[model samples]
Target: MSIPAAFDYHPAQTVDEALSLLQQYGDDAKILAGGHSLIPAMKLRLAQPEHLVDIGRIQGLSYIKEEQDTIAIGALTTYTQIERSDLLQQYFPLMVECASIIADQQVRNRGTIGGSIAHADPAGDMPGVILALKGEIVVQGPGGKRTIAADDFILGAFETALEPDEIVIELRFARPPAHTGSAYQKLANQASHYAIVGSAVVLTLDANKTCTAASVVITGASMKTERSRAVEQALIGKQLDTATITDAASHAADELELVSDIHGSEEYRKQMASVIVRRTINSALERIS
Candidate 1:
């Protein structure tokens, strides 16, 4: 049986209490939210933090609200909540669509978006989608709160820009412009359900079906989720056609130093990157048309 190492558990009732515990424990402490990822690592001895500060009971941190031109989701919000939210479905269907396919129903009920993003696993699907949609991560610490763009939040595998004493508070996303559509496509490993190669695309088209803006992001094939500048450049000002998407998606791996693991070879992942990007782009275009 897999079992975790010895550790002191601190269940914080408020965000301030969580922050104070983190400050006291310093680097030896780990924040526990959903614990879907961290607990497994602990059992494997891959993570052996001396202290665990759990903030799952912090009230008012699991809401979804629309404010003017943006939607704000509390960090502790579960994947199940996002999947079931009528507001999220109406405004950002991409998020709801992606949430529906994450793991199984049980994991969805327990896994929080904040925990998933903070874990920063290379195979995570949300990071790529967030990058494509230009989401922001809001965090709070001893100095107060600040926001960082999705592109700058995840540094690498199992890493983030969050300071040791900081905790994620919420996620903010600007409402997409009119005539905009987005989609996420992924090839997943059968056992773990983690992405083998995933792509997310967001595009804004003018009346003539010419792309006014485009953002492409890919994951599971690199050290971190990365925006595809080459793909975006190829799509901007161009119509979404077979030839245009093919040309753009062909550059999916151009700027990435891809990951090679037992599940896939580097060359195989490179090929799938383009394939997923093309499919994702096609899906987004269909939604608007």
Candidate 2:
């Protein structure tokens, strides 16, 4: 890969300072968190920002804590941190599972959740998990801070709703209801460990083993992470059994704008989506209390 184009670096210790720098530089600046994604893109000349506002030094932006009814995660929290977090293990084990399988140890230690989501790679594992869990992304800009639902935050490949002057600060996930369980399943590329196709599911069950609510999201098969509304609609209010799950999972790729590439053809990805979705939902059901 070619060396990254020359760029100026500014280290910001506070969120306000970061926002100010972003405003000053506008679209010419890129926020650097762990640099796992940004640096690679820069080296490949896919991105050539003139200024990099390094926010790794920013405090209060790398924590995992419960706030009121939500589990709040700082944007700069690395994948390794999520993989090892006791709190996340207890409350959102699917996130832990997802984190554990991302890339490899070295990448996980340096890849921030915010950077991954903001990069919005089609094969990224985080976006589907967050969408399934109904998380919110909190961002700060020149005006003020605001929260965007995960469903609306990620727009497409390498795209998000963030303004040029905004930086992601936090991610918030509401505590799941009792008897809720979640799972993530991926068909990983052997070389890079990026998902060829992945699915995430969250299911809330009643005492009778009926699914009260369901969220099914798939990534890597498409240009962006997307909820499988047809699959969800087929599960809610129904008793989850092998037959039901099989039927619902058949819709995993419904309406999805699947991408065809060297990793897999569109048809191959569509077929695998159903298989992974089934496995993910079954795994989630087994975890329900």
Candidate 3:
């Protein structure tokens, strides 16, 4: 049996206390939420923090609420919560679509969105979805609270712009305008179910069905979720149809350096990137009335 390295455990009941623990432990500590990823990494000896700060018990950190202009979700909100949220189903079905397929029901029930984003795994689905929506992540540290644009938050594989003491507190997205639709599509690993290539699209169309604004983000093809300006530019001002979407998807991952592993080559992943982007765009456009 794989055994994790011994570490001191600190359970925090409040965000402030969690912050204090983080500040005290610094780089030697890791925040434990959901524990789906971290615990396995620990068992594999991939992560060996000296202190484990348990924030799973922190109150008021797990919620999904609709604000006046945005949807504000507490950091600790679970995948199951997001998958079942009526507001997300109605306003941002893309999130629900992605969330419903993450791992399995048990993992979805326990895995928190904040932990997933903070981990910044290349195969993660939420990062691309959030990026496509032009969302923001709220994080708190000893210095104070700050908001990070989703595009700027993720730096590389297994990396983020978060500081050692920073704790992600919430994620927010401006409510998409009328005529806007979004969707996510991924080709995942058969065993682990992690994305091999994931694409997310958000588009707003005018009365004539011409795209006014468009955002496309691709994941698992590269180190971080990547925004494809080429795809967006191709779709904007154009009437989206099979041909236009296919042409635009050909530009997905054109600028980013793709990842290659034992499972697939860089060229294979890039090709799949385009394929997923095309499918997601088509799915999103069909969602519009």
Candidate 2 lDDT trough over 10 residues, lowest sum: 113-122
For model 1, residues 169-236, the per-residue Cα lDDT tens digits are 99999998889888988999999888999988899999999999999999899988889999999999
Best by lDDT: 2
**Candidate 1 runs further than 4 Å off:** none
Model 1 has an lDDT value of: 0.91
- For candidate 3, lDDT tens digit of each residue in 164-213? 89999999999889999889989999888899999889999999999999
* lDDT value, candidate 3, whole model: 0.91
Which stretches in model 3 have alpha-carbon errors above 4 Å?
A: none
Which 10-residue window of candidate 3 scores lowest in summed lDDT? 217-226
The Cα error of candidate 2 at residue 51, in Å, is: 0.7
* TM-score for each of the candidates: 0.98, 0.98, 0.98
